[model samples]
Target: MSGWVAVAGLGPGADELVTPEVMQALAEATDLIGYFPYVARVADRPGLVRHGSDNRVELERAAHALELAAAGKQVVVASSGDPGVFAMASALFEALEAGPAEWRLLDIRILPGITAMLAAAARAGSPLGHDFCAINLSDNLKPWALIERRLRLAAQADFAMAFYNPRSKARPEGFARALDILRQECGPDRLILFARAVSTPEEELRVVRLGDAGAEMADMRTMVILGSSHSRLIERPGSPILYTPRWTE
Candidate 1:
């Protein structure tokens, strides 16, 4: 039997949030691979082999998944949030040359799920109704210079921003620099929504000014959004949240 791999997104880990198709994909997988924290999210899952690794070992993790699949193990390479958006799907494809051609030869499927950005956006109200972009503040992979370039473009273009991997121990200044750039372009009045640990028990969402959302209040678990000038905070009797891009025109 030829080897194949399914890159699956397990959603935000609420059983209800997990879609039927993703559940079916997980049920069909013989071997599952993911980051340790994400692996823990599905720890109760049954009848599957788990390969959990530290965050820094993405290449190793992808290589291992390919190896297992090449051995004809029906592998599920899982990612929290969406696998395609700044997650395992890219690593898997990049690591293709590191594995056998046949293993890379078979069809590799990427199944989408609710990414943290979308989940947070929904909970906090719409911030991406029009043009938008996402940026990962982890400067470890891409240079800070490149990140700055993208942030500048996104800001100038007035794209609502969804920031991922906002801060890590080594790069404490990433989000700060990003915030600085946005503030410079969009001004201090811009609304910056910080959604920490969204969809989990520890979830917290706050709307702050672009000048105020800084690393002192953010960590790797945080997903920060910078709303465009068109965004607004609406207060209904039971709800007070941010909304963006009035497309009524």
Candidate 2:
């Protein structure tokens, strides 16, 4: 059997959002490895061995994928949104770097998919039309101080910002602190968007000024975007358009 490992992105929620390249990899996979929820996304079929694991053991999962591939199994590691965006791609590389030298020779591929940030931006006009930065707000891998520092510096530089993992039951207060920091730097009138479950049936999109924006507005599934000082809204009879012009003074 030809052995290889593919780190594939499942895209944001919807089945249609998954890329054809990733779909092909899934179709050919003899073994599927991923977080439990993402593994559940693929339909069960003959000859496909699904290995669903916990959400936090990314590195272990990556090592397992490499091991399976080394043993001549066609393995696909699944990640929601883009695998490179706070997902399994980086973990796969990390494992490869530290594992046996032979692991490096395995056919490893990273497949791109539509991340939640881009999907959320498309749903609510173009909040990321200009220069923007995407940050993962969960402090599980890093320090909260670092997250706050990045938030402050990004605000100072006037970059439209996208935040992921904004809030969770385990760390609910971090997002509230993030809100306080944003208010201090960007002030009350800055436009912020709370887009939850971007392409799914449970999708919810709400735009609010910073002053009125609450921490409770976001959750793990929500993608939060904060417009720069230069961002503008074109209010119409019905829905509004939020975008940042390409040219800045």
Candidate 3:
């Protein structure tokens, strides 16, 4: 059988958020490769072989997928959110570029799914309804100074922002520093959101002012959103709905 590789997004958490295309890819995959938790999200089937690796081994995992595909195995690399957004698709391509020339000729596909930012935004009204930018707060691959620079520029641009990989055990201080920067640049009244485990049973959503926002509000499972100067909250009977009005003066 000819070999192919599909980098598929499982969405934030809910199985229902997974797209039909991704589901089909998963069903047809002969081998599934991803971080341990993401790989475990798939069910065990008779013909499928699952390979789970540590979270830090993305490049290694991508290389393995390519090697498997080169040997005529249908491989799927699973990612929790959209594979293109702070996920495996970029790593897969990076590996492909550095691998054997023949690897470039393989049938590689990226199947999109509901990203965490969008899922969280939907659940918390339309906070991203206007112009926005998404940033990965983790400085694992990039420099912390670069992240800070980008954060300042994004704040200056007055664009609503979504942050992925906000805080983790090893790099707990980054998000706290991020909050400090935003509080300085965007001021105390700016709106911020913490959406944890979005679209899952354990999902939690909180909206707070920038001054009141704390790094402890987020973990690796959390997605953070900061509103542009134009964003505002509408008070309802229960919880308020936060949204960015489309019109700009």
Candidate 4:
């Protein structure tokens, strides 16, 4: 049987949020590969083999998927959020480009799924209903100065911002520094959101002003969204609805 590789997103955490396309791909895959927790999301089946690896090994994981595909095994590389968004799609392409020439000829596909930022936005109403940007706060691959520069520019643009990988054990101070920059550029009155483990049993959402926002509210599993200056809250019986008006002056 001719082999192919499908890099798919399983969405944030809930199985119901996973896309049908990704589900079909997983069902057909002979081999599944990804980070430990993402691979664990898929159940064991009679004909399927699971390969889970540690974090920070994206390129190696991509290469392994390609190797399996070249050997006539239908492989699926799973990612937590949209594969194309801060996930495995870019890594897979990077590996393919630097790999043997024949690897490019293999059939490869990317399947999209709901990203954490969107999931968080939905839970909070529509803070991102207007123009916004998604930024990965981890400096694992980039410089801290670059991240600071981007944060300043985004604040100046008055764009609602969604952040991924806000804080991890290795880079505990980065998110604190990020909060400082935002407070300086956007001021303390700006709204900041911490959406932790959205759609999962551990899900928690917190909305606070920049003045009150703290670094401890976020971790690897959390997604942070900072509202534009025009964003406002609508008081309700339960949690308030946060949204930015679609019109601009």
Candidate 5:
């Protein structure tokens, strides 16, 4: 076919954070498809058709993109943050595998962007400098039990952890439960950083001890970083620097 599909990341909120590659893909796209907010990021122009859908219809959106591409449409799937990192890239591939054989022959590309985890880490002075792992705290797709298990295991393994979707109105209590688990496994003294809306005008950063971290500190827009046993802070004048040492003895 003469058409292609590109799953492009819009990066963490800031227009400057968006990579040139994604911008180019967006410019070349004849049709743009993704969740409403993400698709809205790309300004409308002549010859560019935007297909915005709700957040819950990932599979449907992916299938639509594939169908459009198969019919010789240049499609771009917009995703917030890195498309491959807990975003539309995986959903697109899942659709491809379950789709017709001819869909596999269509050109597909994944464009990377600055993920919220990394953006949050930078805003809080590199809490992820050492070994780290990212876990989505929302249990929309996965079970709460699995999320709890992973949280405990990650703490036990001494990995500086980044959390996405830390809290939401629908599942507000989950983050509180998570904090209780963290306090139990990592103790009250462990470091935690809450970064909200990184690189945006509404950005806010807060660092505190595990005991001091309230569930209200994080909402869906916040990225929470739980420091490993080796993570520490350097206090000088301004907001303290939270960093995990490269060498943990």
Candidate 6:
């Protein structure tokens, strides 16, 4: 509660996902900055000031957070999913880099939390049983060419893939294009795991072949897992969860 700020991931919605360190950080924070919905997740806690912004106001949000931290406030910049994976931590750092030297002296810490891909993989039953990679298909910040290149490489290498930002309103066909390219590299027999709004009330999940993952199945909130050639389906009595190893046994 003394120096700079602690940027932490709240992990999904479950209270169990919040680590004790993050909880302590939150309890000590004088100010919190996050997207509106994620901010609402921790609203019940007392005495914490919050600055909630819309998704489009990322630069503003980052600047505001850094300003408070630079002013010697104990700030917690929260992201619902892991801070490192397509979250505010990078944005906040980028803003600080372009701003003044004030942030240079402030203590900055990053706390890891459950990423959406890990959550989805756990729920889908071993979709990533070998080498895997995660790719964000959103072209807002990154160009389609870069995404396409990664997709081709992941597919060619037969690495399972966890796809974030698979689709948005402006680019509805992005997932479809990616699927086609993946099919070319890994073939149509490969599996695609779709998990939407994981750990939330409206959660939904599915396992389908690559050739069949169309527009109706994906959206902004969806996370897709495309299986590697080594991956296989495991049918059990109840729900399924995916597992990919760091090494083959």
Q: Clash pairs of candidate 6?
A: 125-240, 125-241, 125-242, 126-241, 126-242, 126-243
> For model 2, what is the C-alpha lDDT against the true structure?
0.95
For 183-212, candidate 4 gives per-residue lDDT tens digits of 999999999889999999999998999999
Between which residue pairs do clashes occur in model 1? none
Q: What would the TM-score be for candidate 6 when compared with the true structure? A: 0.92
Q: Candidate 2, residues 152-242: lDDT per residue as tens digits?
A: 9999989999999999999989999999999999999999999999899999999999999999999889999999988889898877888
Worst 10 residues of 6 by lDDT: 240-249
Alpha-carbon deviation at 67 in model 3, angstroms: 0.4
- Residue 239 error, candidate 4, Å: 0.8
- TM-score of candidate 5 on Cα atoms, chains taken together: 0.98
TM-score of each: 0.94, 0.98, 0.98, 0.99, 0.98, 0.92
Clashes of 3: 0
lDDT string for model 6 (1-249, tens) is 256778889986777878888888888998988898888887556777888888867777888887888777888888877999988888878888998886777889988888888888877876666677988888889888999999887777768899888888888888788888887888777778889988888889888877776767988888989887766666676655445545654
Cα deviation of 93, candidate 1, in Å: 0.5
In candidate 1, what are the lDDT values of residues 47-125, reduced to their tens digit?
Answer: 7888788988888899888888878888888898889998999999889976667765766899999998999999899
Clashes of 6: 6
Q: Which pairs of residues clash in candidate 2, taking residues 3 or more apart in a chain or in different chains?
A: none
Which parts of model 1 have CA positions greater than 4 angstroms off?
43-46, 237-239
| Predicted candidate 5 versus true structure: per-residue lDDT over 1-249, tens digit per residue | 789999998999999899999999988999999999999889999999999999789999999999999999999999999999889999999999999999999999999999999998988887999999999888999999999999999988999999999999999899999999999999999999999989889999999999999999998789999998999899989899999889978
Q: lDDT of candidate 6 vs native?
A: 0.81
Q: What tens-digit string does per-residue lDDT give for candidate 3 at 1-249?
A: 499999999999998999999999999999999999999999999999999999899999999999999999999999998999999999999999999999998999999989999999999999999999999999999999999999999999999999999999999999999999999899999999899999989999999999999999999899999999999999889778889999899
**Cα deviation of 114, candidate 5, in Å:** 0.6
**RMSD to truth, every model:** 1.7, 1.0, 0.8, 0.7, 0.9, 2.0
Per-residue lDDT for 145 in model 5? 99
